[model samples]
Target: MSSDFEGYEQDFAVLTAEITNKIARVPRLPPDEKKQMVANVEKQLEEAKELLEQMDLEVREIPPQSRGMYSNRMRSYKQEMGKLETDFKRSRIAYSDEVRNELLGDDGNSSENQLIKLREERAHLLDNTERLERSSRRLEAGYQIAVETEQIGQEMLENLSHDREKIQRARERLRETDANLGKSSRVLTGMLRR
Candidate 1:
């Protein structure tokens, strides 16, 4: 890490830290408050993007390697969405079948009745599958959020360990200084040797 790079990094971090913290606060907001918060974030992101583009065009050039970001945990959500959809479909079918039998009687009646009932069941299943798709999408989005949060927490704990080590060293130095304080103070108290 070059000094100049570290200096720029710190400067940029200072500039954006408040905004980053504000973004981090989204999860703490209730669903009722999210619309405004989301709008604010969307505006911020757009403005930031345009400013960055102008910077790249006129002032500082951003390298290709650092240009964009994509979340890796998104793939996990894709996988989970599929599983959630299947689980939802299975549960809905089981529950609906139980309810249908209780209300419409068991399936020992005429063939025409059974056919109509089967068609109705099929339509209901189709509706449920569509609903489940929307639900799974929303659920996976939250799952991805949660996974990212856990990752950030792990990073925070690692930084905390580093801070702990520094604190321990400072404490040790303080003890050593205290032990030698009396000898050092005597020379000062004597005004060079009284």
Candidate 2:
């Protein structure tokens, strides 16, 4: 392996070990933490896969030689790299499946299942909120009706007061006329006696 490959190999080793450790601890981790850990491991697995592919590309890029010795070494390197590639691909697939399982727990703990449940809960809450809003609107309407009724009652009382005042003035005018007629009749009687 070239010097460049050494770095990738080290990275692949570290990432693989990290992914293994994290995946092993997933079941023990709390749901909140476990979800994040699983996501991180998934990214790590992807990085590992990339490193493996890079290593394969580097092996293929080795320059050809006219001599059979270099050609033989290249063939041997290709065969070994092919086996490593297969192993890495298998591991990558397995890790990807594990990520899916972790996020979508098999037994009701799946993030996907929880998302649906939470959405339903949110919809139910919104329905209750709409009901409350409608009830408040009805309450407001009832209050407006009560206020209008009160205003009507006040107007009726004011009109009745005006009518009563007019009747009282009419009674006063009739009494004054009756007194005037009595005075005039007395004057006429005196005049007749004369």
Candidate 3:
């Protein structure tokens, strides 16, 4: 195996172990910390995915005779990644359930609990609506910027076209001047000969 391949393998090992440790720690963390840890783990998982792709590409570049062992290792790594992702998801679900239970309490079916749930839902909807409105405004701003950029580009192209036409006219004048110079030289030669 190439040194680069070995390096990537080592990096992947360390990353996966780190992710696994983070996932395990999520259960013990406070709600805010758990959220942050989960986000970090998710990002690490994406990095792991990229490393796996790099390893797979590296394996493909090796000789066919040597490929079988690397291929097996790749399969094992993929299975490990799958298990890690599943564990991460399970941890997230467990955390969510814990939060939900804490919020709903033992009398989850009571009228009071139902009213609380309704208010929470309403607030969540309001937050979503505000986020959507903000997103729409941002999209409008982006569209306006794009339109202005296109107009600027069009004006630049027009300026270039005008410059090209001016150059062409200058070249035409130069040719006419050369022709007149040649005619003047011939007339002078004829007069000298006479």
User: Which has the greatest TM-score?
Assistant: 3
The lDDT values for all models are 0.51, 0.58, 0.76
Q: Write the per-residue lDDT of candidate 1 for residues 1-194, one digit (tens) a residue.
A: 23443343344334333334434444334444644655665565455444333333422243443322122322433343344334434534544454556467565657548756765675575456546655765786677568667767887999999999999999999999987897688868887776
**What is candidate 3's CA lDDT for residue 59?**
95
Instruction: Quote model 2's TM-score.
Output: 0.40
The C-alpha local distance difference test score for the whole of candidate 2 amounts to 0.58
lDDT of 1: 0.51
Candidate 2 at 96: error in angstroms?
A: 27
Could you tell which candidate, 2 or 3, scores higher by lDDT?
A: 3
Which regions of candidate 3 deviate over 4 angstroms?
A: 106-194
For model 1, the run of ten residues with the poorest summed lDDT? 65-74
Best by lDDT: 3
lDDT of 3 by residue, 1-194 (tens): 57878798899889977887776666557789988998999999999999999999999999995565567667767867886797788668756865776686645468557756654564464445445544654675566557657667887999999999999999999999999999999999999999
What are the TM-scores, per candidate, against the unseen true structure? 0.39, 0.40, 0.53
Clashing pairs in 2: 105-110
Candidate 1 — which residues are off by over 4 angstroms? 1-72, 76-119, 187-194
Clashing pairs in 3: none
Q: Write the per-residue lDDT of candidate 2 for residues 1-194, one digit (tens) a residue.
A: 46676576567657655654564455445556766866776677667667777866665666643223323333433443443344334434444544566566655556657755644564464445445544654675566557657667887999999999999999999999999989999999999999
